[model samples]
Target: MSNRAAYETVLPYVREWVSYKVWQLRVPGVQVAVGYEGEVLFDEAWGYADVEAGRRLTTTDLFRIASHSKTFTATALLQLAERGALRLDDTVGTYVPALVDGGSPIADATLRELMEMGAGVLRDGHDGDHWSLLRPFPDEQELLALVLDRGQKVPAGSAFNYSNLGYALLGLVIAAVSGKPYNEYVRESITEPLGLRNTGPDWEPARADEFVVGYTGFHAARHRRRIDHVDTRAMAAATGFHGTASDLVRYFSQHVIGQGTLLTDHSKRLAQRKAWSATDDPAGRGYGAGFIVDRIGDREVRGHSGGFPGHITQSVFDPESGLVVSVLTSAASGPASLIATAIVRLLDAAADADAPGTPIPDGVDPATFTGRFANPWGVTDVARIGARLVEVDPSAPDPLDTPTRLEVVDADTLRMTAGNRFGSIDEDVTYDRAADGTVRSIRGGGGMTSEPWSVPEEAPETAAGLR
Candidate 1:
């Protein structure tokens, strides 16, 4: 199937899944934007931008995308390289002379090493309490001083150690090489040319009202207190970008293979090349310049995840399918990455066009398959929507948790089809019937069994309403 066709097949479940997540995780707000076949297929926002003020989140609402700023910074550096202004292998001392004069180890590290987080620079410098919101982010003077004094934590060209400080130094490199401030250069060159009106190097005072109010303490507790936004100043190139979900996906579209409007094909490849293995990653992700490269099934995806004081965000792009997904959430601990990846899995399942078993015969009552069942893991509800029988997890924060489709193979046996973070699923489901012809329990190939469950009398009004 074509990319658009694949997307359309899964579109119906997107909103329901997102809503379930917002309700399940108690996320204050969320924004998601999806691009397919060179065009945006979905751009939506959910919940509130400001829960206390009763402000609803919109597609245009700006979020502090934080570490995603590194991608733009990396792009700008590549742009300079393309123009012969600099080379990736050039040592930091070649551009910024202060580190060399101060005898900092990073001064000997090449620009490529810094960009790939293999320079082994300290993740943050001494007195990095700024991240705790106790003090403001560093200015150029403070950042330079920190680098000059603390130096590298590990030897250059060592294991991957994600360093905001490394990107911050790149911001300085951009200024030193381009003779323009990092933010000014990025805005004039990248955002302007791309017509990304909703994106900027940092939060703009004029657009402050459009920004979502980030929150803290929401991950572990229901009560979340608002946190104030701060300027990153010199660190803008590292973790200081603010943008809407739509603009983020659009920016990533430029990086798709054969798109080539921004950087040359060679430059794009160099930036996306796996420079180092992120061995610490349980998912086996790799670091590629500014992007995190990983595989979902057989397709390779490149993107970045961002975390600020109160906002968490993730974006991934599959060049083969021309699909990009971005998820932004207001809470500091939101599952932005998980949600984005799950959506990609759904699209992949649609493109594969492989559902389990044949459809139920016509004239068979769909209600026969409809009921709520429970297992040790959670509850699963089978319901008929239109002409299809779908299994959903009413208790899951992700509505997409249930099987995509359930097809009857016999009176008491069925096959469940669904997509997960890794890929597609096709498994048999068997139902145990009581003497009265009622489903006593349901079991899947995985050995998990779900017994009949009814909405409890004391269940929350909201829970009952979902039935």
Candidate 2:
């Protein structure tokens, strides 16, 4: 039972959402969990994780956390930090000697930089396309060799450009410093201590009956097998963990309540503190560490979002409410953050309705909210046609394409219409323009962190060298 049932009032709203008319025309299955003031307010699952198999996502249904797994990877590194095995400022080259490209000092890069996406590497896969093809796939050392020769064009610690390769390197570092396989270290360091039984890499096969089989290639025009592949051997630290909503409820409870076992309060602060940015997101908001921090209703909220080919996951922590809300979706089209916002609003409303109602705050000034601001994510070379719009020549949709579009939507919000190209309808998280009246930054709904900005300092050059 919650200290207060008022928070659970979000359930009806969520039920309405699950059964909404717009949803049917949209995505397929979704699983969501709400933890309020550190307690499980609602832990319910709806829709199907495996639609073809007719598997309904139960509150306990396990789904691939996708890149939400990075949150755990960050946690694992912090654990190593607490033990003094490595410092956040320690260079990558210092920890994982193999990451050095041709004796270059990748190790001199700080863990803090790598953890925060400031490390200037591309979002390349851990191994070559043939990574999964090799028998007894190459270990981290061999994986490093695959990209070691491919040196970076940008100097280390140049602005924030997220690279999956960086975390992959951190995974290797965690393994080296702990003297244990990354998976085993994570289990002992995080899952075991937190009592998160349902959480681990390989959601299925590990639990089989309890885990939802994630599907890939959703809505692909071409017919393709809906396959579930676990690159745990190669991607364990960066993208390997799995768990259920109930487990997360327990996980949230432990942390928000000062359980004090798994992570120290100081470490928790480091975990949540804002660090880096995506430079520019199709949305706004600056990136901070692994989390995206933004303002909502006179309060700052911290969170992150993740999507794999088949799964999309979102989790947010409301410091004001001591509430942590997480939603995991197995469908490619499912929108998890939308679900999270709806839940948050419902709870906030319920919180107010429970007590004597305070006057609703005056709406923010309509003036400060409008304008043309660009931070690299949407393409709106053409304006909206009537009520509906189309995306023409959006983001460097190709590997060589430079994504440079200043998305224009309603004031203080980003509502992008998905075309044949973009799969998700991203939300624009609005920020209060600095008193300076220039864009301090803006954040998008995808939870990709944006950062403090300088406009004439016009937008950061995301297209430079694209040619």
Candidate 3:
């Protein structure tokens, strides 16, 4: 099936799953957006932006987006490189002489190393109390002091030592080379040219009220406390971006080759190419210029994850299908990656149903057999994706991992045609209908009964020390 067709089949399930997960896990709020073939196919939000104030979250609400700023920083550098402003192999010390003057080992690190996190600079300097709001983020003078005091802890390029300080130096390099402030250059060259109205490099006092109130996790605490938004100061290039989910997916979509004119096709390819392994597993994960090279289902995706004080976010793009998914949340401990991965997995299932080898059973509308059912064991979702029906365990971390394909057995009976060893293959699933032609209950293998399940009308009550 075409990418658009697959998205149509999977979008309904995506919405229901996101809504259920947010409520089940007691997340403060979540905003999700999907981009397909240069267009946004699905955009939705759930839960409250401000829990205590009872403010419902909306698609337009801005999120901190923290580490996602690295992608923007990387893109800005690549743009400058294309214009013959600087070279990737140039040592950062060539632009920022403070490192050389301080005799820091990081002075020898190249721009490429810093962008890909290969530089041995300290992750967040000696003290990272700013992350917990105990101290203010370092300014230019303090950042220089931090670098001179304890920035380089290991030899450059010895290993993948993820460092926010490394990117901060790159920010300084951008300013030194372009003769314009890092944030101003990024806005004029990236966001403005791409028409990204909701995106910015850092917190804006003028738009303070436009941002959603972020909340702490309910770990070891009776209730989640609100986290005050603060600027990342000199580290804004590394961890201080704010935007709506819609604009984020749209911005990343430009990275997909030939999708947008923001960056040259050559630059996009270089940004998406795997430069170094991010993990020990040979084929597990890797890193590009600023993108996280990983897999969602069977498709390789390039994107990034962001974690601010009380906001967690994840964005991934499937280059093969040109499908991009972004999940933004208000709680610091939210399952942003989990929700984003599930969306891609569902799309993979829908695309599999269209494969020539897997023939979808005909003469029985899969929709009639699709609905959420509850038994004493747990909840089961019979989702209809592109004319195929699969039983999904809603609570699984990856819902489509071991799907049970249901086939028509009779008017009211279905048979499990395919599944893993854990599933009961060829088992009959009979359902009873009410007078109005609505399903009342279902009887599966071993004669276990399940009734229709619905999400709660309101958010679940929070228990002490637990959501």
Candidate 4:
């Protein structure tokens, strides 16, 4: 099937998994949106925007999409380049001479170096406690001071050095070249033109009520505390965009190759091309001008992730398929990438189910066999993806990892068609139902029994008994 078809087929499972994960991880709040063929197919949110006040998160609530601001900054720079305002290869000192006159080596770095994260600058400056809200984010003067004092980590273009400090400098370059403040230039040039009403470069006091209250990650010793929204000031270009997952996915959809009004197709190509290998990533991901270029399954994707003091967010799009996924969370330790990747993987698996000869039998309803089940061992979720029913381990890091394909036999019986040797391959799986036809229990896989999940799971009893 086409990706659009596959996404439609598996959307229910994706939604189920997303909701389950939020409950399992105890995330304070989450907003997830998926864009397919330039339209948002799924948009939902879970948990409380303000847990203390009992305010639920909505799809419209604004999130501190930190570092995603880089994409906007990079796009702004490319727009200027397209208009002959400035060249990417121009030295930082060419526009903002303060860094050069201040005797900082950072003045010699090119705008391209900064955008590609090859400028070899500090990740954040000394006294980075501002991230924890101990102090304010750097103002222009303070950011310049940080750059002037030993900011260069290595020679420019020698290696991939991820640096918020570099992008902050890019903001200055933008301001000097455009003769407008960084935020104003981006608002008029990018967000406004795109018709994105909810997106902006920094926290706005006027829209404070629309913004969700970010929260600290769960602590074993204490409850999560709320994090106050603060202006990023000079560093806004690097880490201060506020937006919704809906707008985020839509914005990222514009970055997909061949489908954007924000930049020329050529500029989009330049911005999304792999510029540097990310040595810090074990997955061997690469960085583009302002995007993280990585693979999920076999599909290459370009996107950006953001981390504010108490919020973590991820947005990605498959250029070939025009599929986009964005996850926004309100806690420091939220697994935004993990959740986003799972959505992609599930869609991929659904796509594979559309291949020839793997179709479910005639008159069989895969959805009838789908539900969450619990046994003494753990939780198992039987889900319908595309035309296939597969046993999914919801607790697994990748839910589709080592899945057992279930084939329909009769109305209530399914046979395991494929799985590891330890499983009951080719064995009949029967479901027991209540009088009203709701699934009561399932008997399958190594002859183990599981019932529809209910009741809270309790901690295992030790030799000393449950604590």
Error of 2 at 68 (Å): 1.6
The lDDT of each candidate is 0.81, 0.57, 0.84, 0.85
Task: For residue 295, give model 1's deviation from the true position in Å.
Answer: 2.1
Off by over 4 Å in 3: 353-363, 420-423, 459-467
- Clash counts for all predictions: 0, 27, 0, 0
| The best candidate in terms of lDDT | 4
lDDT of 2 by residue, 1-467 (tens): 24256554335444444434123323445667777655666677655555555555577677767666677778778877888888888888887766654575455678888788876665664444432334433356555764475535366777777666677777877888999877888888878887787788544464666766544333554222344545556666656667776666566554443544666767777776666544466334555555566654445677667665566777777644577778876645556766666556545544543332122124533234322234455322221211112222222222112212223444445444343334435544555466777655555435554544211211111111001
RMSD of each: 6.3, 15.6, 2.2, 3.8
Predicted candidate 3 versus true structure: per-residue lDDT over 1-467, tens digit per residue: 67578669878988888887887777888999999877898999988777666678899888999989999999999999999999999999999999899998888899998988888889988888888889999898888888888788888778777788888888999999999999999999999998889899999989887788888886666567778899889999999899888898889888887788778989888888887887788688888888889986579999999999989999999765678999999887889999999888787777774432233466666667788898889888888766577788888888877778787777788888788746577787998999876999998745699999987666423411123
Candidate 3 has its poorest 10 consecutive residues by lDDT at 458-467
Clashing pairs in 4: none
Q: Which digits, one per residue and each the tens of the lDDT, describe model 4 over residues 1-467?
A: 66678778888888878777876777778899999877889999877777666677899999999989999999999999999999999999998799879988888988999999999999998767778788899999999988888899799989998999899999998999999999999999999988899999999999888898877665542456678999999999999899999998889888877787888889988998898888766566999999899999888999999999889999999876789999999888788999999999888888884432256777777777898898888888888887788888888878977888887788899888887758788898899988888898999877999999832433211100112
lDDT of 4 at 324: 94
Clashing pairs in 3: none
Query: Which residue runs does candidate 2 get wrong by more than 4 Å?
Result: 1-5, 21-26, 125-142, 203-206, 216-225, 253-260, 279-284, 353-467
Model 2 residue 3 lDDT score = 28
| Candidate 2 C-alpha error for residue 455, in Å | 47
Q: How much does candidate 2 score in TM-score?
A: 0.68
- Clash-forming residue pairs, model 1: none
C-alpha lDDT (0 to 100) for residue 250 of candidate 4: 85
